[model samples]
Target: DNIWGAVALHNFIEMLRSFFQPVNVHVTIADGNITLKNDALLEILKA
Candidate 1:
């Protein structure tokens, strides 16, 4: 059915996104400098 196919497609997209998406992680120093990938930040915001 259409509903089943939509669910399958959504699952596939999520899987692909997870597999291809990169994570943004940071370690701060006393100097207070920040560095991170924008894509990772966007992903976090999407969640």
Candidate 2:
């Protein structure tokens, strides 16, 4: 175990968010807008 584990995880999450967010994408939840991660799945559902 290392002290950088949390920092590493935080970096990974930020990378994942950047990778997933190619489009100007959002989902309309009852509470508020949420980012939709899966582009292919969204396209399939839209069809």
Candidate 3:
């Protein structure tokens, strides 16, 4: 599906960014849902 493909691309971008970034940015699927979790993202979410 297109949604899954988009998620894959997003995850790939995040993975590449993680190399130069400090925070561990990554994505995964949980219970048929997309889960994007990372310290940088967490902080943004908390703000």
Candidate 4:
């Protein structure tokens, strides 16, 4: 059940990523590194 739960969440994240445009989200770039807000990274981390 635990494994299934993780899988389900992973799949949901993947679906969301497919539907959502990353480019639409704002990001900051400095020192040759792209920085995104915590919420943005959290969203990607979900996958």
Candidate 5:
């Protein structure tokens, strides 16, 4: 049961990581390009 619980927790963490990966990418991109902030905001809004 403990092993299964660990596996479940790992899966949950992986899911969260995948979920936020795109947001992190967008943030990095926006930080790199001040001029693209408007475009990035629009893309985020559309998403």
Candidate 6:
């Protein structure tokens, strides 16, 4: 189940990368927290 979860996450990231081409996308999971970084996303949120 953990492996499946990882695979699903990888696929999701790949999908996001394609959708946000030309922008750097990063995802970090630590201490039970998830952090995502992307300038494009920030712009969307600021709008």
Against the true structure, whose lDDT is highest? 6
Best by TM-score: 6
Q: Considering summed lDDT, which 10 consecutive residues are worst modelled in model 5?
A: 24-33
* Regions of model 5 farther than 4 Å from truth: 22-47
Candidate 1 per-residue lDDT over residues 12-36, each given as its tens digit: 7677678878564332223233333
**Considering TM-score, which of the candidate structures 1 and 2 is the better prediction for this target?**
1
Q: Rank the candidates by lDDT, best first.
A: 6, 3, 4, 5, 2, 1
Which structure is stronger by lDDT: 1 or 6? 6
Cα-lDDT of candidate 3: 0.57
Compare candidates 5 and 6 on TM-score and give the better one.
6
lDDT tens digits, residue span 1-47, model 3: 35575587788778788777756655443433544445455444345
Q: Predict model 2's lDDT versus the native.
A: 0.50
Write the residue-wise lDDT of candidate 4 on 5-37 in tens digits.
Answer: 548866876776778945444333342343334
Give lDDT: candidate 2, residue 4.
Answer: 69
Please state the error at residue 38 of candidate 1 in Å.
38
Model 3: lDDT of residue 26: 50
User: lDDT per residue, candidate 6, 1-47, as tens digits?
Assistant: 24565588789889998988847767754523533356454443345
Model 2: what TM-score?
0.38
Whole-model lDDT values for every prediction? 0.50, 0.50, 0.57, 0.53, 0.51, 0.61
Query: What are the TM-scores, per candidate, against the unseen true structure?
Result: 0.42, 0.38, 0.40, 0.43, 0.42, 0.51
- Backbone collision count in every prediction? 0, 0, 0, 0, 0, 0
Better of 2 and 3 by lDDT: 3
On TM-score, the stronger of 4 and 5 is 4
**Backbone steric clashes in candidate 2, count:** 0
Tens-place lDDT per residue, model 2, 1-47, is 13364367458667767999655544333313323366554454345
Off by over 4 Å in 3: 22-47
